[model samples]
Target: MPYLVPPHIPSGRIADGAQPALTADGGLCLRPWEYTDAPAVLAAFSDPVIQRWHLRRADSEDEALDWIEQWQEAWLAETGIHWAVVRPKGGTSDGAEQLLGRVSLRSLMLGTGQAECAYWTLPAARGQGVAPRSVTAVARWAFDEIGFERLELAHSVMNAASCRVAAKSGFSLEGTRRRGHLHADGWHDMHIHARVRDDEASCVPVEGAGPGAP
Candidate 1:
């Protein structure tokens, strides 16, 4: 019998195994989500802005735990990858694991050498360059370490902030997908941004404990 999944990625194509806890410059840490992070998870998703764009929203501690579990399950199946964007210990009142935001590579089709990227920064983390910095770090890991040939980022055309994130993190505007999908507010034209392994404008990976873009 053959494996049933389509756009199938043989195990060897994902030889990188589970996502590693990557350390980026400026004390940004991208690590697998933990059950203990539920409280912060609930807090971040409470923001109306996050609610508008994302499918997950956890109003209680228990719901937040469920959200974390899904990411864990997705990891085991190799279908998606998510990370908790946190800060160094003593960097904030929450200490080392301050949940700055999230960055993910989803809809993975390693067989096609590509994946989709999504990210959001907590309301408190805005204006601090959290999204761009963390995204660049994760994109670098996706390209240099995981060997993905192409990475994609798409957002509602009306999302100017997200557009900025895409640009600052080294993705180039590919084109528009007119009325590509419907949203709560009705259909939205999507702006697609992309970066390739060999792109001249590709972002450099974040280095630890130094002054570099992360």
Candidate 2:
């Protein structure tokens, strides 16, 4: 028996190539995480705000390195891709790239053409619109370049900041899932937001991103 619908995106399309760095607004760029960034990763996990949302902490430099290694390998496995949002060399006075936050397309389903977007900003990068810009950049790459049909972003209802980022990045409010996740504090209602490829409110034309402009 043949299936009625074929896969929207074929396997190995993305995994076959190196993960490309994406350009975002405010002179920020999203690039693959490197081993040398372990210290910054460790610092990010130490921040109370980041820890509260992330639910995991790096106990040592070794743990942070492990996490970075996992992120790098996930790209080749086609399960996920994580980008380190950074202020590239010229963007900072120190002339060295500065890690600002992280954005990822997790739970990626190539056949389904969907994935979940997740992000967190370091304490110093908060209030700079880093989260929203980074997310939009990745969405462009996923939708315009890789043919992803839909991308979803979910956050705890109590997280007003996440809600705002979703809105800013043009993700529409779908609904709420009661007790969607259990956090350290307790079970909390989760807000579900989504942006489809053809959505006018979110999907915009990617400059020089090939023929598909939806």
What RMSD does each model have against the real structure?
5.2, 5.8
Identify the runs in model 1 with alpha carbons over 4 angstroms from their true place. 1-16, 93-96, 202-214
Per-residue lDDT for 1-214 in model 1, tens only?
A: 7755554345554534655888765678899999999999899878778877774577799999998999988877777888998886888775554777888888988777788888887876776767777778887888887778898999888777787778777899999999976777898898999988887544543222111111
Candidate 1 has a TM-score of 0.85
Clashes of 2: 0
> Which candidate gets the maximum TM-score versus the true structure?
2
Instruction: Compute the lDDT of residue 205 as modeled in candidate 1.
Output: 31
Superposition TM-score, candidate 2 onto the true structure: 0.92
TM-score against native, each model = 0.85, 0.92
Superposed model 2: Cα runs more than 4 Å off: 201-214
Local lDDT at 115 for model 2: 97
Writing each residue's lDDT as its tens digit, candidate 2 over 1-214 gives: 9879888889898899999999997788999999999999999889877777777889999999999999999999999999999999988887988898999999998888999999888877777778888888898889999999999999888888888788777799999999988888999899999999987545432222211000
Candidate 2 deviates by what RMSD?
A: 5.8
Clashing pairs in 1: 133-214
